[model samples]
Target: MTTHAPQTPGHPLPTGFPAGTMILTRRGLVPIEEVIAGDDVFTHQRLWRPVTAAMRTTAPTVRVHCASLASGLAATADRPFLTRVARVFLEGGEAGELSSAGWTRARDLAEGHRLASPLDFGKPVPVPDLPASLTGIDPADVLRTAGNMIRLKGEAAAALRPELVDWLAAQFGGYGARRRFPAWALTMPEELRTAFLDGLVNDGPQRDQFAVRMHSKSFMVGLRLLVCSLGFAGGLSSQGRPGKPGWLLSWKREGGRRPDHDGFRWHPVTRVEHGPEAEVFSLSVAEDESYIADGIAVRNRTERLTSL
Candidate 1:
């Protein structure tokens, strides 16, 4: 003779989603149920947190449809979603505007509530000066080294010109060298950065829909990082077939107004529907107790008791 426990708003219910939900991770978008402990997921703060635990359970769930996310977000009713509540103005001598935001339970969410989405990508960093050692190098030598790196020859090689080709070779290593870009790559000036990328695209495989392929895995990784820092969506993949032994990097530009927070863009909720009970998955992140699923930020049930 046992009675069912009552569930209340903000109760410490387990948080998770059904099998089809996509979880954003460092590797890319992966199914939530497929994610295991020790995988790093992208958070609302634009940081990566390792999954401390992964669990599967049967529970009631809700489907939240938000702008820009076609499939919608599905999770337990008590799951906390990062939301923007309101806008407030300070009443001091100076008039300052601020946005009020916090975590709201899925059961309380409704149409028009703004959900925090991650920024498409970050902006390009500015490099103040060229490396001291490569500053005085002759343009011919730089051009020659750059051409040789990609096996370019003749008039086309001459056309593939950049002021800092030698610096690129030195910084990124010689041809076929597998090494990630150094720290200084985070602050490359626009002109020099563009020149470098253009040089590679021009000499490498034919560009198709803004995608480029390269032979070095580390080079592709570093190139993707640099491209992402320039506020473009840079996706990396490997050409892992029998004949193809290299990597591919593709990019797209998502131009829009900047979000209030550098790491998040607020997107409005379009629909919220309660769904039937089913199996779901959840993760215990190292910090923040939060992770973005299909671009929607949601809280994890890391603690036994979490208040609204």
Candidate 2:
């Protein structure tokens, strides 16, 4: 959800598109069902714009829903992942369990409040007015902790596991409403691109770590921290990043793949802030060569939840 000047009113969807709305496709675009669903979560879409030959994707509002909770049905609270995360604040607990980085990031977000796509901010995006919410927040904390609660047990990340981590990474890893920019827009200076790549592969993939790849290559890999820029969001921008940020890497893969994986790939996508909810973020990916510039892999998505 790239930030729009006057955002549209988004309705709360009981769930995002029914689990199996996407029929099987020869393309690697797997059905949402392919993702594990222990949480009973589902996503449905409200389209604002349709994908066109000129553009790879349509503007749409995706509502993530879970079973409603009632005092009589308090047990249902265990269903949605976000509920569990919020429980930390509800349980009269200090967020000390959050890593120092996490703590710092959150404290920062509390200050500079902003938004991204309509999804990031919630339905009926809030209009950004001059408020303390827009000042002095570390976008890093907001990215790391929002919609996530870290339990300092055995591996800290273990609490979230494949479920929370996978979910968070998907939604927030790439793009949002505030930063209308995407992966393709990350303009790293030439020397920095190589340095960034070197730093990423430094450990040669930790079994417990996360990774962002291109041509099956590990680019920036690690527990990343991010924040949406204050007030200004992407999509509303007239051009890509102010300067080219990273080296363009082109490649080819013969087997199953995504368009973004084609001779199309970019590193360190852009991040910006826009909506009332700075959590609203956006990112763009380069298209695969075969699919042309506008391909599915190169498309953008809005994440409702994620952890830095």
The top-ranked prediction according to lDDT is 1
Question: By TM-score, who's the top model here?
Answer: 1
Cα lDDT of model 1 by residue, 101-139, tens digit: 788888898754667765433333333345465577753
How many pairs collide in each candidate, listed in order? 0, 44
lDDT tens string, model 2, 155-210? 45436333345433443242221111122112223233233333333332232222
Cα RMSD of all models vs. native, in order, equals 11.6, 22.9
Candidate 2, poorest ten consecutive residues by summed lDDT: 68-77
The lDDT of model 1 is 0.58
